[model samples]
Target: MTWLITGGAGYIGAHVVRAMTGAGERTVVYDDLSTGDAGRVPREVPLVVGSVLDGGRLARAIAAHQVTGVVHLAAKKQVGESVGRPLHYYHENVEGLRVLLEAVTAAPVTAFVFSSSAAVYGMPDVDVVTEETPCRPLSPYGETKLAGEWLVRAAGRAAGLATASLRYFNVAGAATPALADTGVSNLVPMVFHRLTEGTAPRVFGDDYPTADGTCVRDYIHVVDLAEAHVTVARALRSTPGLDLTLNVGRGEGVSVREMIDRINAVTGYDHPPTIAPRRPGDPARVVASADRIATELGWRAAHDVQDMITSAWEGWVRLHPAAARA
Candidate 1:
């Protein structure tokens, strides 16, 4: 059966595509290439250049590809940007998801895997949030993700479609040779860019209650995250029940200072990070209690901080050797 991956040309989506294609699966990529690059997709895979908001086009692509399952990964993701443009976030994330769901309902494609976020938890009082945690999203981005999950759950219940929403936290690291141009929104990549450019990475708020007084986050490697998607797809095919929402993470929190130190150690960058005040809506700490996915799917993250940093550094260096030299 063919699988449709929306936003399949993006960094995380591209990795998912690589994993799916590498395993000999029939996969079709649907990306608008707003922030995604067509060149990032594997040459062999078929791509449908269209927006998720385009229901007619989406339905056509789904039917044409004979897609039986879908992995929805398209959405506006920048936290700060989402705050400034709440309507845009709602439109792209919520409305786009609505359009996709409508198309799926009409087409009878049941199996689905949603790319969710830990942002839905929104600065929870607890450091590690589980699947059962109450959602109290802070930013517009988080709210949109939560709304998307609600839509998925509703659709699954109403239509008996098997769906899994993987709530990811602080996805980092790279999985391909062309990684330096992977975009500048993620922390690790932006930090790597600053270091490579002979500058220190910026550190926001060093006065939180954590050790080292910085925000702590769960930085799961992209490869491990991609593996989780594979597991989700397999489970949907094999399992009977519907509507699963599980946290995808390493189950450990790494402080911002700790990450910077590790990056410095890995890249031999000696410049100290520039300290800055905390931005609004910035949480003191956010970690994942990923035991649900482990117990349910028997999956675990294999890469540690060193592996994440080294692989990311290698990918960056491969793309920009001169930057690595600095």
Candidate 2:
């Protein structure tokens, strides 16, 4: 089963490509390099550089690689930025995906995996979010993912294809320092950057109802998340007409204050964080149930919060040697 991975050179996407290939799966990478790094693609894997919006390029990549499966991971993901440029996000995430679906359905590909997000369940009220959780996305980025899932599932049913939508929570750490997530969009990297600059990391807010009165989130290790993709891919290959939607998370909610404390202990920066007003779209608590993925693929996260901080700090220090001195 030859698999084509879009955005394969990105932080999470890179991990997926490595894990897929390591499992003896035939894989090809398709990335536009807008937010991806070409250097991250392995020499053994063929890299096709083109946007998913380009239907012709996607069709060529699928046909040239003889791809039988696809894992779509390319999209605009920042919440704030999506708010500012809703049209751009829709064009990239929604329209780009529509173009991809057209190509895959026209080809012989039968298995598809979408890189979804917890943002699809914006401000989930439940203690542990499940696959059946109602989706009320807050940002344009999240809305695109939710819409993409519907589109993928519908297309799969019509074309007799197997598909899975994996909604990931907060992802951190790296398999190696060079492959670490360099973007400062997520929490861990943001904290690393703040401490590296000898400034106190800013906790968005501390007035929430939870313990420590800070926003709580579920964190998942990048390595484990990648492995889940491999399992899902294999499952799709074996199960005909399989349409699965699962959450990828540790099922534990770590408060903002708790994460900051751990980051300080791991990095030795130990700077006190200053509290600011809550961001507009920030959720109070959104932990995953994780039971569906476990039952479906027998997969559970092996790494914890400490593991995330240690590996991420190593990568941060690599990019900014001055971080180690702090």
Candidate 3:
């Protein structure tokens, strides 16, 4: 069966594309290249350079590729930017999904997988969030993701299309040998950038309710996260009744200070991290249970914090070797 991976050249999408290709499955990539790199995609895979906002282009690609399934990963995902530009987030994230859904209906695709975010849970009173957690997003990014999930569910129910929305936490590290050159948004890469510049990386917030009094987040390695997508695709093909949203995380939270310390240890940097005030709308702690995906899809995160940091540091160094020195 052929699959359509929107934003397949992006950070997470590129990894998913590689995983699908490695599994000996037919795959096609659709990306606008706003933040994705064309070189990240494999030469063998068919690349359709187009936007999901363009219905005609999307329809043409879907039909031309004869794609039976779709993994929608294209979206504007930045908490700070979303807060500053709510309209743009809604327009791109929400409208883009609408246009894609329209195309899926026109083409009558069988299964769809949505790349969702844990931001939908916001700052839950409890540290660990389950799939049943009430969604009260603190930022426009989270709000649009929640809205996207709703749209997917509604459209699925109406169209008899099997859907799975994977609500992932902070995805870090590089999956393949190829490194990303632009639009690296995760904390690890940002820290690597500062460390290479001979400047101490800044840690936001040092006084939270967590063990280290710093904000805590669950970070899953990008390769493990991509594997979860493949598992979802397999489940869609095997069990048609599996239509639900599942959280993909390591079921643990690491503080910002702890992450910095790990980076320092891995990079052997003597300089300390610069502690900064917490940004507005920052959550205290957010973790995921991930029991559902484990029990249902037989999936679990394989990489730990060390693996995440090490792999990410290697990719950063490969891209900017000058940053690797003291």
Candidate 4:
């Protein structure tokens, strides 16, 4: 089936495109290039330059490509930015999804895989967060994602569209240096950027109840996360009207202190991290229980924390050659 992948030129989107194409699935990339690099898309895939907010453009691309399935990944996804610009976040993330869903439901698209986030379960207190966990999103970004899922489900039920929402945790690493994440918004790249500038990485807090006293999170390899998308996308293609909401994570928690230590080791740097005050709304632990995804699709993450840091560092060095010397 020919699938239309929105935001397919971004880091995670690019990985999903490669994984789907590598598995012999036909895909067409739909990106506005606001934050995506057109070069990330493969030469073979047709790149449609458009935003999800544009229904006419979306419908045209869907029809032009004879799209049967869609993977919606285009959205504004910064917690701090979302807090500062709630309207922009709601418009881009929530309203964009509403428009896309309207277009998809109107078309012959049967399968949809939405890019959800663990942030939907903001400040989860449990050791391992399950899908049944109460959703109390802290930031507007998380609220948008949660609302997006609700819209997808409602639209899918109304239109008989098969759908899956994969709530991703901390995604890191890269399949290739060129395909690696270039943005410093994430933890891995943030540390890399600090090290390249000969400064210590800052840990948010060290007074938590955890062993390391720092916030704990579940970090999943981008490759594995992309594979989960492929698995879910194919599942929706095969199983009609199947609705799934599963978490894509390693079922393992890594503390901020430990991650910084690992990053230091992987990058061959001895710089110690500076302890800072805890950021507002930061959870002590937000690990996922991958049991649902594994039981539903037999998918599991293969890469470890070391794999994530090492590959992420390689990509950082490629972008900043001086980082290698540092």
lDDT of each structure?
Answer: 0.88, 0.93, 0.89, 0.93
Tens-digit lDDT track of model 1 for 63-120: 9999988999999998888989999999999999999999987886879889999999
CA shift at 218, candidate 1, in angstroms? 0.5
List the candidates ranked by TM-score, beginning with the highest.
Answer: 2, 4, 3, 1
Query: Which residue pairs collide in model 2, if any?
Result: none
Q: Poorest 10 consecutive residues of model 1 by lDDT?
A: 176-185
28 in model 3: Cα distance from truth in Å? Answer: 0.7
lDDT of 3: 0.89
Q: Give the local distance difference test score of model 2.
A: 0.93
Model 3 reaches what TM-score against the true structure? Answer: 0.97
Alpha-carbon shift of residue 14 in model 4 (angstroms):
0.2
Sort the predicted structures by lDDT, highest score first: 2, 4, 3, 1
TM-score of 1: 0.97
Greater-TM-score candidate between 1 and 2: 2
Give the clashing residue pairs of candidate 4, or none. none
Q: Residue-wise lDDT of candidate 2 within 147-245, one digit each (tens)? A: 999999999999999999999999999999988999998999999999988899999889988988999999999999999999999999999889999
- Please provide, for model 4 over 1-326, each residue's C-alpha lDDT reduced to its tens digit, 9 standing for 90 to 100: 99899999999999999999999899999999999999999999999999999999999999999999999999998887888899999999999999999889888999999999999998887899999999999888999999999999999999999999999999999999998889988899999988889999999889998997998999999999999988998899889999999999999999988898999889888789998887755677899999999998999999999999989888888988878854
Worst 10 residues of 3 by lDDT: 176-185
